[model samples]
Target: MLIKTIFAGFGGQGVLSMGYVLAYAAMVEGLQVTYLPSYGAEVRGGTANCTVAISNEEIASPIASAPDNVVVMNNPSLEKFQHQILTGGVMFINTNLVESRPVRGDIVLYEIPCNDLAHDLGSDQSANMVMLGGFIEKTGLVKMESVRSAIGDVFKEKKKAKEMNLKALDVGFDYMRNNGGKA
Candidate 1:
């Protein structure tokens, strides 16, 4: 199956890292994968976007002109990429940041209150992992274990963040499992 996903948000929200994790997870699964990232000039105040394509066969494109899924961590990202979601694709929105309705009804939608959840979990920094969890559960792009492995790989040198990242992902998964992609 072809799995194309885009992670977009403000520069420091970990969009590129999230893309790498997904791409790495796909590679670990022995699937074809590609990762591409674009960042605007203002650094933290600017936008950041990354695309990942995964397939069992050769991937025709890595550009994701129309993505099968999108994990949006900010309102601007939602406004910008919401139109690009393919029919039946899944969109994971961070409810803590975005309050707008999804632009496309043809695709599945998952809302996550990443910031609040992260804060409740003791740090506001784990929002990215929470959003990652929502993406995995809603799309089933890869197993959560694979995602967990990816987390290990991505945070290889950042020992302090490892546990929090894992916990955030689990929180996201549990929340989605309990909420069933609603609200």
Candidate 2:
């Protein structure tokens, strides 16, 4: 099986972190994975994105011209990458920050209020984790336990951060499972 995903948002939204964690989780599952990150010169507020490809067999390239999944964390990202998704692919939009919706009808769409959900969880910084959780739940690409462990590994020095991120992940996973396409 192979799945290529793009996570895009402003630099500070943890877009690269989302891709890294997903790639790490896939690696932990013994899957072949590649993560490529790109950002504008002025990070933080600038545009940032990452592409992650996970496959059971060898992958020919890390770049995905047409991704299977696109997770957009901001309106700019939504506008920029919405049309790059392959037909029948899935797109997860952060409704809290994105005002415009995709016009495509062939792709599956999931609207998630990631910032709101993370704020309710105590920190908006965990919004990326929230989106990741929902995507994982929808795709079942890697086990949730693997993601938890990957989060622990990523934030090994900060216990509270790890806990909060894990909670945020669980919240997103549950939100997707319960709400499906609705936010």
Candidate 3:
């Protein structure tokens, strides 16, 4: 099995972190994974995105010409990557920040209010985790336990951050599960 996903948003929205955590989780599951991140020179507030490819077999390339999944956290990202999703693929949108919707009908779409959910969880920084959780729940590409473990590994030095992120993840997962998985 193979899945290529692109996470895109403003640099401070944790777009790279989302892809990193997913790649780490895939690694923990013993899957072959590749994560490639790109961002504007301005860093925060600038455009940032990452491509993650997870596969059971050897991957030939790190680049995703047509990603199987696209998680867009902002309107600009949605506009940029919406057309890049493979037909029948999935698109996860952060409804709180992105008001525009994709025009494509071939790909499945999930609208998640990530920032709102994270704010409710007490930390707006955890918005990415919320989106990640919903994506995981909808796709089931990797085990939840693996993601939790990866999160722990990524934030090993910050106990409070780890706890809050984990909670945000759970909230996203539950939100997707309860919302019937598609928009």
Reference-based TM-score of each model: 0.95, 0.97, 0.98
Predicted structure with the largest TM-score when compared to the true one: 3
- On lDDT, the leading prediction is 3
For each candidate, C-alpha RMSD in Å? Answer: 1.2, 1.0, 0.7
| Candidate no. 1 TM-score | 0.95
**Candidate 2 lDDT over residue span 21-125, tens digit each:** 999999999999999999999857999999999999999999999999999999999899988999999999999999999998898899889999999988979
Q: After superposition, how far is residue 128 of candidate 2 from its true place, in Å?
A: 0.8
Residue 53 in model 2: lDDT: 97
Task: Show where candidate 2 strays beyond 4 Å.
Answer: none
Q: Residues 85-181, candidate 3, lDDT per residue (tens digit)?
A: 9999999999999999999989999989999999999898999999999999999989999999999999999999999999999999999999865
Runs in model 3 with CA error above 4 Å?
none
Ranking by TM-score: 3, 2, 1
* lDDT (10s digit) by residue, model 1, range 1-183: 888889999988878887888788888888899999999997786999999999999887789889988888888999998888888888888888888878567887788898988999996888888888877887778888898898898899998798899999999888888888675
